[model samples]
Target: MDKKKTLLTLSAVAIGSVIYNYLKPVKSDVEVIQDFDLQKYLGKWYEIARFDFFWEKNLKNVTAEYSMNEDGSVKVKNEGVNITTEKTKTSIGKAKYAGNVNEGALKVSFFGPFYSGYNIVMIDSDYQDALIFGDNLDYIWILSRTKSINEDRKAHYLKYAKDCGYDLSKLKWTVQEG
Candidate 1:
């Protein structure tokens, strides 16, 4: 009887852990750009700014390639060159629309053993620039197709970032080389 109770308790604990991890809240105050047009947004987006992460640290010439997949999802190919090691790593994933036209979000996952979060927090009217967030606050990125963005556009995004509770000082501008 004691052994059976122990097994049941362990089973309950294991189930609870799985549920906790799966149902973890990853939402932030950042609003999804509702006016996002997938057609315009689909392309090679250069990393303009990002919150530092180990995999992306000291990485340069980073860009995310997006393509439409037959599975009714957007294929994501994130490639970057490690400045320190001069090595390139490419991670492949897929994303689907999760919000409406005006307030749009995306859920992306690598063809992994498990799924992860990839949310779109903000985007420009022309879809020329965007800010993305992931499962945690640590995952933040600003992307643009061009190496440079207009001053006014930058200002607008910065304001949005502030509203989203991001520390402006923590935003590291990606170094683009011509």
Candidate 2:
């Protein structure tokens, strides 16, 4: 009887952990950009910089393409080149606005049904540059329409990101060699 009870308790705890992880709310201090226009934002963007992660390790020349799906969801196609092998890698995902369409917060899923936060913290008027944040400080990205961002804009973004509590030291400047 004790063994069965222990097993049940363990299972319950495991399930609860999963639920909490997936449903945790975004940090209160982080704000999503309002007045976002998905139509203008949909296009190819170069990854100017990003926080290093396991999946993108040793990758360079990363680019992301966004397009509207027929069902009103956004289609995300990310491509990167392996620096050592010079081979390209691609991952396709889907995104849906988490709340109001004007808000820049979206739930993105590369793995089906397992959505993660994708918030546009800031975007230029021309949609040529953007700063993105995930649910927490673990994820951050700087993107641009061109391969590189100008020094002034880069400095401004760095300052903004730092002010937002992100550690800029972990940022990996992506190589965009065409």
In the predicted model 2, the residue pairs found to clash are: none
Which TM-score value belongs to model 1?
0.77
Provide the overall lDDT of each model, using Cα atoms, as 2-decimal numbers: 0.76, 0.90
lDDT, candidate 1, 45-93, per-residue tens: 9999888876678889889999999987889899888888889888888
Off by over 4 Å in 1: 1-26, 99-103, 111-113
On TM-score, the candidate that comes out on top is 2
Question: Alpha-carbon error at 84 in model 2, in Å?
Answer: 1.1
Model 2, span 153-178: residue lDDT tens = 89988999999888899999999996
**Model 2 per-residue lDDT at 99:** 95
- Once fitted onto the true fold, the runs of candidate 2 whose alpha carbons sit more than 4 angstroms away are 1-28
Candidate 1 residue 152 Cα shift, in angstroms, is 2.1
Candidate 2: worst-modelled 10 consecutive residues by lDDT: 20-29
Residue pairs with backbone overlap in model 1: 34-101, 34-102, 34-103, 35-102
